[model samples]
Each structure stands twice: as structure tokens, then as C-alpha cells.
Target: MTALLTLAVLATLLGGTLFAVALDRAYLPLLALFTRQRVETEAPDRLNRDLAPAWYLALAAIGIAVVPFAPDLALIDSPVGIVIWGSCEALIVLTVFLHGWSPNAPFPLIGAYRYAAIGLPVMLPSMFVLIAAALPAESLSLVAIVDSQREVWNVIRQPLGLPLFMVVALAMTLRGPMDYADAADIATGTSAEDSGAGRAVWQIARLAMLVSVSAIAATVFLGGPLGPVLPGPVWLWLKTGALMALTVWIGNRVARTTPSRMLTILWVVLLPLSFLHLLISGLIAL
Candidate 1:
């Protein structure tokens, strides 16, 4: 039984990794083709080559880490679970900066700067939720949190935490309309000079990574791996996919905003909300 469960988790992780690869391959090319058309007309083409491979690889790595860690990871249930999980999130953020800066293009560089600038503040709410989890479990291990939530998902008790986590995750991924950092209209976005295989990797990996991160967040804070009729892992995945759909739909619906405005919104609006959520979650823990 243990072996079978392990295999199932491994398979899910593999599927996520492949999905990331496929998405990266599919989209990077389209972006390149679009840029080519613009370049041909002497309009402007900014996609850089350096951004693709590394970005895809980074996405794949995050996919591997976030997916398997959802329902179970012995390490994440240990004393240092918080540090491990938080570091994992930080790594993903770092990869975003790397993807933005490595391109050596003006737009991508600017995008990286914006990404770094806004990333920290938004992550606070999620971080606080994780901290709150530590309070109850008396440990940082995710397994402990899951065990605690078996009786009730954290979302029920900490409603605000989920939305804050979602917003941060979406903003970090820059999907849909939240893509102010890489807003295509800006004429100075992160992926302005990539092409061919490189472009393919970046686009595919990024979308996959976004989906994977959403899934991870859902599992961690949204009562992942918990359902009465369905199996725990299956329930976790369903919730994760649902969240991804929500993010994509939301992303598509919103109009593009300027980076400065996005930053302002995060600072003035989202930050306070996130901080409030954290405070409330702390009270819930109490």
C-alpha cells in the first residue's frame, strides 16, 4: 500500500513535470513567431535567447518540488519544514529574477527589476500562513499540517489566507492580466529577445510552473489531500486544478496595468490586506 501510494505521488509529479515541458515548448515558439512578425515589419522584437532554457529548467524543478510535496514529504514534516518550504518558494522567485535578468535585454532586465521589487511584499501573506501552520502543528513539516487539517481544511479557519496566497502566486507568475512586469504592450518586458527552442522552453515552463505553484499552494493551505469520498491525493489535485483555472480566468479577464501601478496596488492595497490576513490567521491559531 505504501509503495502504491508512493508510486502514485511519483507519477503525479512526473505528469506535472511533463506538463510544464509541454507548455514551455508550445508557448515559447508562439511568442517567438509573434516577435518574428514584428521584427520583419521593423516594428520591434525583444525576446532574448538566454531566458528560455534556464527558465524552463527552473520551472521543471519547481514543478518537481511543489507537486510531490503537497500531500506528503517526510522532509517537509520535519522540524525545519517551514524553512524548507519557504526556501523552495524563494528559489522559484529567484528563478524569475534570473530569467528576467539573464536575457541581457533592456526589457527583460527592467522586468526583472520590477519582479524583484514587488515579489517580497506579496509573499508576506503566504509566509504568514505558513507561520501560522507552524503554531498548530508545533512543527514545520507539511505532513503535520495535513494531519491537523484532516479534521478541517485551513481555508475554513483562515479564509483570508487562501486569497492572499492566490494573489501572490498569480502576481509572481505574472499570468493573465497580472503580468505587469512582462506586459506585452510595455515594449520592454522580460521575454523580449528569445527565439526557437529557447522561447519554447520559457513559455511552456512558465505556464506549467504557474499551474504547479497554484497546486502546491492549494495543497498546503487549501485542505489539499483531504476529501471524504475521494482519496486524499486525488482531492488535493482537484482543488489545485480548480485554483489554477480560477487564476487563469482571472488573469484573462483583467486589463493590462502598468508596472508602477501594479506595484502601487500591491503596496497600498494587497500588502495591507495580506498583513491583516496574517494577523487574523494568527488569532485563529490562538
Candidate 2:
């Protein structure tokens, strides 16, 4: 199961990386793998800076491991799998913050603080959304969540769930509109100091997190691997890939707002909507 999960992760990551690279950028990750150099930082937290991407990648792996490629099949099928995934989402904010803060540069610190601010609020909606998603299933298990959708998808049951969760996804992966951590304006933001092999690893870790979030999104809202004729894993792959593309596309097109404005929108608007969504989903589940 672990090997199978690893393959799935690799395949999804490859697909997402290709899709992202094909749109509006050259392939630099491979080249970075060969090059090795970085500008010196003044009194940087070497340990955290060096380990941040690895931690991010590990979180992605753990999150994706809970997603069932087929019914009852996953690297980790904990009864509270959704909760475990949620924990990963929460930890991602810290990991990304560490990525920025440990660099000990102005831009990186700013990017780290910005992401932390956005990421903290995003978690409120995510909690409500995830709970709403689990309501119909009446189980925190990802497999049971998939099973609940055998009759009808949670996308229909909880209309606001996926869109709201997308905020969490974008924040978690630092992609598209929510990409403050590596925004170009700040010289790649949190990664402003990154170069060569290190940058490559960071890029891969970001993509891996993207793939991980897309898989969880597919499972929670899109019926996971449920389908006819095709194998369960195939169904999962198709859904996950489609979602990864959608996330990247949305990220590319959505106009980014200033951090303060985004925070207002999230708290003043999206957060309340998630509460309503939870109420509605609970009623439906009842």
C-alpha cells in the first residue's frame, strides 16, 4: 500500500508539474537539481531554512497517504482520516512560515508573515467545510466519506464546501493567488534567497503539496475513486488530475488582492458562508 501510494503521489506530482510548467514558464526544476549555490544570509536559522522544504514534502506525503485510491485502500486508512488531513493543512502554514522566516531576509520574512496571516484565517473556513463534508458520511474516515458519495457527491450535498476548501488548498501549497510565500514581486518572496539545488527542491515540494491538496479535494468533494467500468484507482487519478489542473488554472487567472483585503474577504465573507454551509449540510445529513 505504501509503494502504491508513493507511485500515485509521484504520478500526480508529475502531471501537475507538467501542467504548471507548460503554462507560462520554462522548466527550471531539473536544471536547479544540478546547480548548487545560495547567497549568504545574515545570522539565519540554518536548521529551519534547510529543513523547511523537506518538512513540507513530508506533510504532503502524509496528507495524500490518507486519500483512498480505491475503496478501503490507502497508505493510511485511519478512522479519523479527514482529521489527520486537516492537521496536515494546519501544519502547512507553520512549515511555509518557517521556510520564509528561517531565511532571515526582509522579503522572506515579510512573505512568511503574510502567509501566516492569510493561512490562519483560512483554517476557520476549512474546519467548517471539512466537517460539512464529513456530515453526510457520518464518519471522519476518508474511505467512508468516499462511500457516502456512492449515491451522490458531497459537491452537490455541500455546495460551498469545495470552493471554500480551495482557499485552504491554495494557502497550503502557496500557489496561484495565494502564493504570497513565493510571489515574484518579492523576488520569489519566501524563497528570495533560494538558488540552484535548493530552489529545485522547494519547487518540487510546493508542487507535491499542490498534488496532495488536489487529491484530498477530489476525495472529499468529488466521490473519490467511485466510478463504473474503469478501475477505482483510475477514477481517482482522473479526478485528481482534473482538480490539479483546475487549481492551477484558477490560480493563474484569479486576480490577487492585497493581504488586508484578502483577509477581510475571508473573515468578513467566506467564513460566515462556511458556517451557513455547515448548518445546511448538517440539516441534510439529519
Best by TM-score: 2
lDDT of each: 0.62, 0.85
Q: In the order shown, what is each candidate's alpha-carbon RMSD?
A: 5.0, 1.9
lDDT of 1 by residue, 81-176 (tens): 556656656665666676666656677778777777777666666677677765666766666776677777777877776777777667666676
Q: Report the lDDT tens digits of candidate 2 across residue range 1-286.
A: 6786779766666775566555426476456555677666889998998899999888888887889988888778899998898799888999989989997889999999999999988889988988898888889999999999999899988889999988888888788888877777787789888777777788778877877898899999999999999998888878877888888888888877888899999999998999899999999999
**In model 2, where do residues sit more than 4 Å from their true spots?**
1-33
> What TM-score would each prediction reach against the true structure?
0.78, 0.93
The TM-score, computed over Cα atoms with residue i paired to residue i, of candidate 1 is 0.78
Local distance difference test, candidate 2: 0.85
